[model samples]
Target chain A: MIRPGSTLGILGGGQLGRMMAMAAADLGLRTHIYAPERNSPAFDVAAEHTVAAYEDEAALVRFAKAVDVVTYEFENVPAATAAILGAHAPLAPNAHALAVSQDRLMEKTFVAELGIATAPFAAVAGETDLVGALERIGRPAVLKTRRFGYDGKGQVMIRPDTDPAEAFAAIGRAPAILEGFVPFEREVSVVAARTAAGAFAAYDLCANEHRHHILATTRIPAGVSRGTEEAAFEIARSIAEALDYVGVLAVELFLLTGEDGERLVVNEIAPRVHNSGHWTLGGAVTSQFEQHVRAICGWPLGATGRLGRVEMQNLIGDDAHAWEQVLAEPGAHLHLYGKAEARPGRKMGHVTRVYPESD
Target chain B: MIRPGSTLGILGGGQLGRMMAMAAADLGLRTHIYAPERNSPAFDVAAEHTVAAYEDEAALVRFAKAVDVVTYEFENVPAATAAILGAHAPLAPNAHALAVSQDRLMEKTFVAELGIATAPFAAVAGETDLVGALERIGRPAVLKTRRFGYDGKGQVMIRPDTDPAEAFAAIGRAPAILEGFVPFEREVSVVAARTAAGAFAAYDLCANEHRHHILATTRIPAGVSRGTEEAAFEIARSIAEALDYVGVLAVELFLLTGEDGERLVVNEIAPRVHNSGHWTLGGAVTSQFEQHVRAICGWPLGATGRLGRVEMQNLIGDDAHAWEQVLAEPGAHLHLYGKAEARPGRKMGHVTRVYPESD
Candidate 1:
């Protein structure tokens, strides 16, 4: 087992890695960040860092040898990189999780096979496959690349009158999955953690709002029925168990309210700490970042009790310019990512406001 | 004003600096730690660090230029060191605060001048002064070096038959102070913060216990009347205002529960985030470390509301070997400094228990 002073190797250097490093430090663990970027934000807070590319096998070997365990901030870790690091150190969430979550088709099939609800999705290997998928799944389906997609990138919404060929071309003819829209009443997610020993804990459901396909806000006590929230938690637990997961994972679900009453469909799964769980930093007894660290380190999990009713708003671009005003507001917790640029659609930081449930 | 990304230079590499750096990261501020010791605990978490002597003027200037503001984790920051850093960057709590806190004689005089009650003390420069002080203050008093003392170090108790010259020699014949010990019920501390703008917030009073003159544990709800707690806060506020202090300061007090009713006498002042305030990290709405960062950054103060009935225990020396057990216990928050050795009398870490007040 990794002790308090052991070093944890993290693969990635974005805000998620930075936050995770901070959490590890809180538990007396030292973190060494491995990324190709110079002056990566995570590097600032990490005890050590390696400036090398993911494909640099020698660097990866050195990094794995230096830490007790290895974990990554993103799911798109290259297969070769994961294998090289795993050969030298214990890798949390396992390589199987990376393979499944990296591909949309595999992730959907895995979810469907577990007796869980998911959007009707079909594989689209080529233009002919795209046509067949469109005819079978319906005209107004969403075509997404099977691998490496985020923030509405590598996907195109197909309208009833849209050309199938145009949609395929828009995604650069990559292997794709056609998902039939669910007409979700609200989008919710369950951020949870699972230890290697099969121990699991889940935070409260969070309803998310997006702007330009980027997450804008997350609110707890998601205006959903108790049953729906429980259902979301169950789906996340089942997925983690199936994957034999170790570390934090987020499962996004679509809550459809129609003639069938309220029901949930598994939209996607994130193998690492998700953006939607940011509120847990100040709103819960244990943050998802810390929970991930604990699970990966084979330590006992902490309480998931919420401190209060909480709402977290992402400070995209210019939104962070109001940090001074946010600091002035009582009961407001502000977190800045320390990114130098504030280009449009960039996530600069976030602010969380917590209110007593009674109020 | 030091903004979110601005760097805060901290002196000393003990647990206090480690915690202060973590809190600075919590608010998106970067920290640069400067300390003489190699492999200091604070180096693991700070954004930047300089391993150089406190007396190294060139290194101090470089460190100051690299950060937006300067603060210290220990009161014995040499006057010249503070002045060099102050000339390069703004130093919070000021040099005068350091001068007052570094010497027991000056601290007592300052407190008394502010209309605050303190133990009767006389400066002892040598054998004659010690003899005079012993004669005037009576037996069962304490002789302590005026500067560079902590955790019962550099002090000796005098009874009726003790030799004054021996007591003075025992403390290395250093300039010292003789305190007429107050007969008190218990020891308490008021951990508070002040901004340059005069904004102040104080955590609840904490009753403390000592083992072999080293602080062993601290409990909140100090077991004192409401008036006594308020008086402790008032004394702390007066000290801060008089010094024009900015950042967290701790005032150790002797709570006397006598026939005349409960009253408090200032014992010592800590011009930095103190050990007694560690409970506030998980037991209060806002932690003292974060409050100190906010104060020194010219930001608004956060709520000082207590979260529950809290008790904090220092994990000195081999006590930290139970970190695993502590982690297994539910709801017990454990923090360990990244020190390689577990020497006796060394503060390795701490654990805090926050029970619901009703429970």
Candidate 2:
């Protein structure tokens, strides 16, 4: 077992890593953040930091040797980097999780093989394959690159009037997956944590709304049927057990309203703490960041009980400029990532508001 | 008003300051910690730090100039230190608060003058004053130095047979106060915060138990009558308004049983966050640390609502060695100060356990 005072090495020095480091510190564990960028926000709050490329084998070896366990903030951790670190220390959410989540085709197949509901998808390796896959998946499908996609990036929509080859070329003709569009009623996610001992705890289902391909708001008690919520949790548990996951993972699903009331179709799996789980920081007994730390450290999972009715809003781009106004509002917990610039479409911070339930 | 991007200067580099700095970062503010010790625990988590003597005018000036506002972790701030910083930037909790709380005689007089009840106290400046005060206050009183006392230090008990001169000399014959002991049932504290606008909010009353004069455990709901709790809050409010206090302040009081039921008498006032308030970190809607940052920054006070029944236990000396066991316990929130050594009587960390109220 990883003991207190042991250092946990984290890859990627963004706000996610910064929050993870803080959670680790609260558990009496030290954090070492490794990133190539100078002024990485995580470095400011960590016990130690190394500015080096992920491909730098020597630096990776030294970082792994210095820490008791290793985890990463993003799913796109290069396979070679995971191998190097795993050789020296325990790597949580393991390399298999990274491999499956990194590729759109593999992720869909893995979820489908588990007898879980997923949008119909086909692989596209070339223009011919794109045409064939487009025919199989039908119009209004999404052509996403097999690797390096996030926040609606590395993908193009294929509508009835749009050309299949053009859509594939837009993604640089990389090996991709064509997922048939699902006109769903709403998007919901199951943010959960799993320990190596196979213990699992999931937060309540949360409804998510997106604006301009970016998450704008999240509300808990998603208004789905009890059956749908239970099914969502079961899907998450199966995914975690299959991956042998040992950290917080989020499963975004499309809640389709049918004759049966509500049906959930798996959308994607995030291997690390997700933006959708930010509400847990103040609205739940234990935050997803802290849950991730506990799992990675091989500790018992904390209580996932919700505090009250919760709503979380993201402060994207210029939205964070009104931080002073937010701070003045009572009952609103405003959190800002220490980023120097307010570039468009950037996630600068978030605000969570929790209300008491009616008696 | 202090803006979100502004810097917050913190005095006294201990766990309270460390948690306060973390809360400042959460609200989009940067922190600069100033302390005399070379390895101050707070420095590891702060954006900037100054290692200098509290009496170092040059360093204090530079620190004050660098930050937009200043606050301290403890009440024993030197008058000259406050003056130096106040000249350069806004200092929350103000200078008068420091002056009043630093000296036990002044604090008691101020509380007593406000029509609030306090343990009968007399100023003892020398052997003559000690003898005169002891004769009047009688035996079973505490002889405390007027300034710079904490955790039962700088105070000696005057029993029935102890010589007054010896007790006075033991405290170095410093200007002191002889406080008439109250036959109290329990010790309780009100951790409250006030803004410059005169807005005040207090957390629920907490009952404290000490081992060897150091805090061992703190339980919320205090097991006190509602009337007693209300009176305790009124005392704290009057004190804050009297001193024009801003930021979090703690008022320790004795819960004495009267024929009418429970009554409270003022014990002492802490100008900054107190150990009794540590439970707020994970068991309240807004932690005392965050409340202090919000008040100092001119932001609205957050909700002081408790999450559930909570118990906070301090990990002193070798007690911190059980950190791993604590981490493995479900629902236990462990907070370590990153102190390098576990010297006897030193506070190394704390654990807070919160239980849901039974319906």
Q: What lDDT does each candidate get? A: 0.92, 0.91
Candidate 2 clash pair list:
none
Clashes of each: 0, 0
Please, what are the lDDT tens digits per residue for candidate 1 over residues B192-255? 9999999998999999999988889999889888888888888889999999999999999998
- Name every residue pair that clashes in candidate 1: none
Supply the DockQ value of model 1. Answer: 0.69
As for model 1, its CA RMSD to the true structure in angstroms is 1.1
lDDT at A158, model 1: 94
Which parts of model 2 have CA positions greater than 4 angstroms off? B357-359
Instruction: Evaluate candidate 2 and give its CAPRI docking class based on DockQ.
Output: medium
- Compared with the true structure, what per-residue lDDT tens digits does model 1 show for residues A37-80? 99788887889999999999999999999999999999999999
**Cα deviation of A318, candidate 2, in Å:** 2.0
Cα RMSD (Å) per model? 1.1, 1.9
Best lDDT goes to which candidate?
A: 1
TM-score of candidate 1 on Cα atoms, chains taken together: 0.99
